[model samples]
Target: MNQRALFAAAAATVLSSALLNMAPAAAQDMGKDMGKEKCYGIAKAGQNDCANLSGSHSCAGQAKTDMSKDEWKYVAKGTCKQMSGLTADEAKMSMTKKM
Candidate 1:
């Protein structure tokens, strides 16, 4: 192959190899949260981890209010209550009582 073509192929191979090497580390970092627990009422506005309890939105970062009792974020397991957050059931009950 010409020098330019050879250089381009080498760069692509290096980039692909670097990305492949990063994939496992990225996956491992994600797995670190596997033991986390959902802590409701802790997420600030637009900072939730996933869907809200009320089903108003089906995606994360959609909370319109802070500590809404419906929004949640992942906290270390058993640390939810310590952070003054509620479980899904408790948040559901709280919302129910408010309505």
Candidate 2:
């Protein structure tokens, strides 16, 4: 390839990789939303849900809150880790678990 063509290809490759890296962060944000919503539903019953959510690529830790006084006093929040090989199904399962 000519110098100009080669440079263009390199730029494209870099941009593609950057976007790929960002995708996991986006997906994790979505998963966190899912987990937080589920946490709300379970919070009333005072249950701790610790499902691994990051598609097995990364395991996002659960947010810890003190539930000493009342169930509503504490809440769990989850955020997906930014990484590759994570699937939607895995994220869903991580967010929604029977407690």
Candidate 3:
């Protein structure tokens, strides 16, 4: 292979190796949520943890407004109320009342 082609292949291998190493750490971070609970009405714009209570979006980080009742984030268990956030059911009910 030419020097340029060899350099490109080496760079690709290094980048892929680095990304593979990161996968385990990312999964470990997700595992930290085992004891967490969903806290609604606390996620800032584009910071939601997963699908929202509303059917508008089906993915995380799609919230358009801060403290939206439909958006949620994972907080330590039993702290949702302390954080001025609501439970899933409460958020759903609140959304219902606004309609």
Which stretches of candidate 1 lie above 4 Å from their native place? 1-33
Candidate 2: worst 10 consecutive residues by lDDT? 66-75
Off by over 4 Å in 3: 1-33
Model 2 scores a C-alpha lDDT of 0.39
- In candidate 1, position 71 carries an lDDT of 90
lDDT by candidate, in order shown: 0.81, 0.39, 0.83
All models, RMSD in angstroms: 8.2, 14.4, 6.0
lDDT of 3 by residue, 1-99 (tens): 899999999999999888766653454366266888889999999988777878787566689999999998888888899999998899999999999
Question: Predictions ranked by TM-score, top down?
Answer: 3, 1, 2
Reference-based TM-score, model 1? 0.66
* Candidate that beats the other on TM-score, 1 or 3, i.e. the better one: 3
Total backbone collisions for each predicted model = 0, 0, 0
